[model samples]
Target: MRATSIGAVLSGALVLSASAVTAPAAYAAETGVVIQKVSVNGGKPIVLGTSQTESFTISVTASDDSGISSKLAFLQIKREVGDNYWSYHGTPTCTASSATTSTCKLTFKLDSGWGVPRNTLAGPWKVVVQLQSKDGDLYNNGGDITHPVLRRGKLSVDAGPEPVAKGKSLRVTGKLSRANWDKRTYAGYTNQPVKLQFRKAGTSTYTTVKTVNTNSTGNLSTTVTASADGYWRWSFAGTSTTSAVNAAGDYVDVR
Candidate 1:
């Protein structure tokens, strides 16, 4: 994952104030720690991309009946957007195997690109966790496993008339965005329902060549006729606060 931990903590200043929705500060269970489950990404609702870097995977279940320890396993993430409040913290990799139970499989990421500089501010994000035990015990709360649908989004495409002539009529455009973070970018994702793939130059697979709906602003035109000459993309397949996306294969040249 070494993208430099995706900006292990890139920030000169973020201030904090996503309008509200902040919850973090209420720990004092005498420090014995016991979180049982916390699954994100796998729980679905993640499709962030302002440029790249989206390696998702978060699975944690901690315990410390005064008998589980061996370092630390943390993953604190928060978000707001509007005013600010976009935090990050990750250590990942905790395992007690079974005894007192301690399991973690963290690999979370949300890089805004520019070499993992993390510009921060995307959408819903909240996964507080901290399981440290080496006699200094400390396990923050996440009780019901954070929520807010765990959303994230960002998508856009534009496979145009690079060179169509075999049968003419090869017009495909796109833009079904999502991800505002108060206005970090991408916003047109209105009528949803986008999918129009095709791959055939050297074919590896990609069939669907229909289904289009995204107007009012999400834009996405349609028109296909030329045959053979592969590559073209646009797939959404995500709902529940946006997630799925596929746009990066624009190559057409049927002559």
Candidate 2:
């Protein structure tokens, strides 16, 4: 079945605060499953070095013969660091009130310096979503559902000016950005490696020629000589766990 596309809004000045402590609520008697659509907005595969921010929204619609009343949900972000795992340490960054009609929607900002740990890689990251009653009953799978896991659909990086040319040596510099989701910037390079693929224009295929690690700033730069250049293109790719697949950035025309 085709999934619904959720829209998100992005802002650089938005700061998401954790909700205060509150007692959990009892589960709702609803019987139908909650259908949600998740998407990233602002920019895909965020660029490295450049400071960028993205927003995400989860629109939920639920119907049950039991009649749904409570309209509260919990959202959390989890990232993989090295061999271990880390989660947003404090309170939930996202919450939604019950809709007066039938649908409930919540939005949050993932800033560059949000909840990211000091040490995070540039590879695949995951965002684990959970829907629960303030009381504690699971929403999706009855009591069996502990969390709703939806991996980021796509992650990408954007490097401006693909076929950057100087004099003779082709000078290319681009920023790395993540798409389909937002990430916090750390003090060093991301745990994942950024791979660059390049091929002369006219070639039927390309090859992996260079690789670089996104620094704390998520910026990368490289220079290569173009031999008898017709046209050339370069690509940058990376991935994370919470995100469903890999992300990429591309550049072209280095003559």
Best by TM-score: 2
What TM-score does structure 2 among the candidates reach? Answer: 0.38
TM-scores, in order shown? 0.36, 0.38
Error of 2 at 237 (Å): 2.1
Q: lDDT by residue for model 2 over 59-142, one digit each (tens)?
A: 334433433344445444444556856543222333333431234444444473443332243333333334443333445322
Once fitted onto the true fold, the runs of candidate 2 whose alpha carbons sit more than 4 angstroms away are 1-53, 70-101, 110-194, 197-225, 228-234, 241-255
Predict model 2's lDDT versus the native.
0.37
The regions of model 1 sitting more than 4 angstroms off are 1-39, 43-58, 61-65, 68-77, 81-97, 103-126, 130-136, 141-169, 179-198, 205-216, 220-231, 235-244, 247-255
Worst 10 residues of 1 by lDDT: 1-10
TM-score (C-alpha) between model 1 and the true structure? 0.36
Specify the highest-lDDT model's number: 1
What lDDT tens digits, residue by residue, belong to model 1 across residues 102-216?
7776675456421212234433466676677556777666632343322344455666567777888888786766654444455687888878888898868888889999999
